[model samples]
Target: MTQLSLHSPVGELTISEEDGVIVSVDWGWSPFQEENELLLRAKKMLDDYFDGEEVEFDLPLKPHGTEFQKNVWKIMSEIPYGQILTYGEISDRLNSHARAVGLACGANPIPIIIPCHRVMGKNGKLTGFSGGEGISTKRYLLELEDTFNNLDDNLSLPF
Candidate 1:
């Protein structure tokens, strides 16, 4: 696996690649000193995203997960940049339960790239996030995407 770390506005992110495909994007820096074309591209895309450029990541990803989890993540990847989806909505699409969908989202190896942060709770409420700073990071990501426009009027942000 090749790992490259880059600092972003949110925090330091370490992207891991295996066989030229992104495997995971973890919070914080990794000491693994390696870089490849894919890693550099991923870093540039992430940089552009953080710069509010509305960049779409077009990299190959190979996240390891169960069949169900992969299905959920695939659905997540289709979520638009500035849109949000509820667990219930995803469950309805997959014919699964909300809790199961939430679990699948939590298990996502790649967070921002796979966009698990775009998933919220019912009524547009904030939910758990596995990333650093938890829901705060999730909120930051949502704000970065300007997804608050899609949030329910009843949903309030800490800003």
Candidate 2:
């Protein structure tokens, strides 16, 4: 896998690619770095996104996962920027369960580009995030995009 690191508001992020397709976007920096046209473009899009530029990523994403997880990721990818979706909504769309959908969201390899942070818990509750500073990272992304429709700033999560 080829990895490239970029600095964002949340912290350092490392984007991984394989076979010319983006496979993951992870927190922190990678020990190794390789520059390429694809990785460079992915970095640029992420920069725009963090800068609140409403960038629609045109890069090819191939997050490594199972069929169900892939389906979940696909649904998440379609969620427009500055929009939110609940686990229940995704479960209903997939004919699955909310817990399952949440699990898939947690397992998402690519975070921002796939928009997993846009997903909320029951009644727009903030939940666990696997990247950066957990729910805080999710909150920052949501706040950055101004997509907190049902979420309030007065949760116990300490913003």
Candidate 3:
């Protein structure tokens, strides 16, 4: 595995790639000195995203997880760039309970790329985020998107 760490608006991010596909994005620095086309592309896409540019990552992803976790992550990838979804909503779509969906989300290997931060609790309440600064990072991401329904009401933004 080749790991490259880059700084982002939230914090330092370490992206790991193996066999030409991105494997995971951890929330810290890793000292593996290697870079490839795929890692470079992922870094560029993440940079564009943090710059408030709407970006759809067009790279290969190879997250390791169970079938159910993979299914949940796949559904998460379909979430719009600046849109938010609730665990209950995902559960309904997958015919599973909210807690189960939340578990899968928590187990996500790639956070921002897979967009587990877009998932919220009922009433758009903030939930757990297994990333840098936890829920704060999640809120920062949502705020950065600046897609809140009512811009006038700062608190109206979905978390």
Candidate 4:
């Protein structure tokens, strides 16, 4: 696995690529770093994304997870930037339980790129994020996307 680290507003992130497909993005720096075309491209995309530009990642991703997790990740990936979806919403679509969907979301190999932060609790309630600084990290990403402000019924951020 080849990994590269970049400093972002949220924190330092290490993106890993295997066989030219991105496999995971982890919090903190990776002690070992390697240079490759794919890693370089992923870094650039991350840079632009953190710069507040609306960028859609066009790189290949191969998140390692179960079929159910893969399906959950796929649905999360399709969530429009700055948009939100409740765990219950996704579970409804998958005919699975909300807790199961939340579990799959928590296991997502790639966080920001897969957009798992877009998933929330029912009624726009903020929930745990297995990446970065937990719920605070989720709050940061949602605020960065300005999603909290757009929530209907004036659903305030749960914090």
Candidate 5:
């Protein structure tokens, strides 16, 4: 596996890759010391994302989790870069329940790639983020994507 470290507003990120596919993107409690071709690409991609120059990611991903978790992650990836969803909405999509979706979000191994931050509570409130970073980080990311701007002004119940 190859690893690369980069900086973000939340913290330093360490992106791990295996077999040429990204396996994880983790927040580092300490600075990571490694670099490689895959890491470079990951850095560039993340930079572009933070810079608002990219939306959907095109890098190889190798998430390791249960089938349900993978499904949740897949749905999360489908969320537009600037859009957000509620746990209940994801459960409806999966024919499951909000608790189940929340569990899946908590178990998300790939954060930014899978886009767990894009998930919010009903009423467009920033909710749980299991990345150990906090919902504020999630909000920051969402705001970066312009998903939160004017959200307060357009407060209409979706369901």
Candidate 6:
């Protein structure tokens, strides 16, 4: 596994990949050490994204998963930057049920790059995020994308 650390608005992220495919992306260090090349490039794109200078990622990413999961990730990859999509919409597109779509979303191997955080429940409700950052972190990501326009005043950010 190859690893690289990236700084973001929420926190520092460590992204890992193996055989040119993303293996893991977590909030902190992992015990395993591996060489990193494209990992560094991913960090750079993430930086540009958080800085609001870049909307889309241009990187070779292969998220390993089952065929169903891969299909879910493909639809997720189409979610334009700074935009949000309901889980139901994804289900409709994939001709699957909403619950199944949610399951695939929770199993997303890559978060920011795959843009899994852009998926939400019906009516803009925050849903599950498998990166283990919790709902607050998920909300922060949505806010960064300018998709959470109805957050409470206290939760509103200056930027």
Among the numbered candidates, top TM-score falls to: 4
Off by over 4 Å in 4: 154-156
Worst 10 residues of 1 by lDDT: 150-159
lDDT of 1 by residue, 47-114 (tens): 99999989788889999999999999999999989999899999999999999999999999998999
Query: Candidate 3: worst 10 consecutive residues by lDDT?
Result: 150-159
Error of 6 at 88 (Å): 0.9
In candidate 5, stretches whose alpha carbon ends up further than 4 angstroms from where it belongs are: 29-34, 150-159
- Please give the distance, in angstroms, between residue 140's alpha carbon in candidate 6 and its true position after superposition: 0.4
Query: What TM-score would each prediction reach against the true structure?
Result: 0.94, 0.92, 0.92, 0.96, 0.87, 0.83
Write out the backbone clash pairs for model 6.
Answer: none
Question: If candidate 4 were superposed on the true structure by all CA atoms, what would the RMSD be?
Answer: 1.1
Model 2 residue runs over 4 Å out of place are 149-159
Would you list the C-alpha lDDT of every candidate in the order shown? 0.91, 0.89, 0.86, 0.92, 0.80, 0.77
Output the TM-score of candidate 4: 0.96
What is the descending lDDT order? 4, 1, 2, 3, 5, 6
Residue pairs in steric clash, candidate 3?
A: none
What tens digits encode model 2's per-residue C-alpha lDDT throughout 85-138?
889999999999999999999999999999999998876778889899988889
**Model 6 global lDDT (CA atoms, 0 to 1):** 0.77
Please identify model 1 stretches exceeding 4 Å from their true place.
152-159
User: In model 6, where is the ten-residue run with the lowest total lDDT?
Assistant: 150-159
How well does candidate 2 score on lDDT at residue 132?
90
Q: Backbone clashes in each candidate structure, one number apiece?
A: 0, 0, 0, 0, 0, 0
Window of ten residues with lowest summed lDDT in model 4: 150-159
TM-score of 5: 0.87
Deviating ranges (above 4 Å) for candidate 3? 150-159
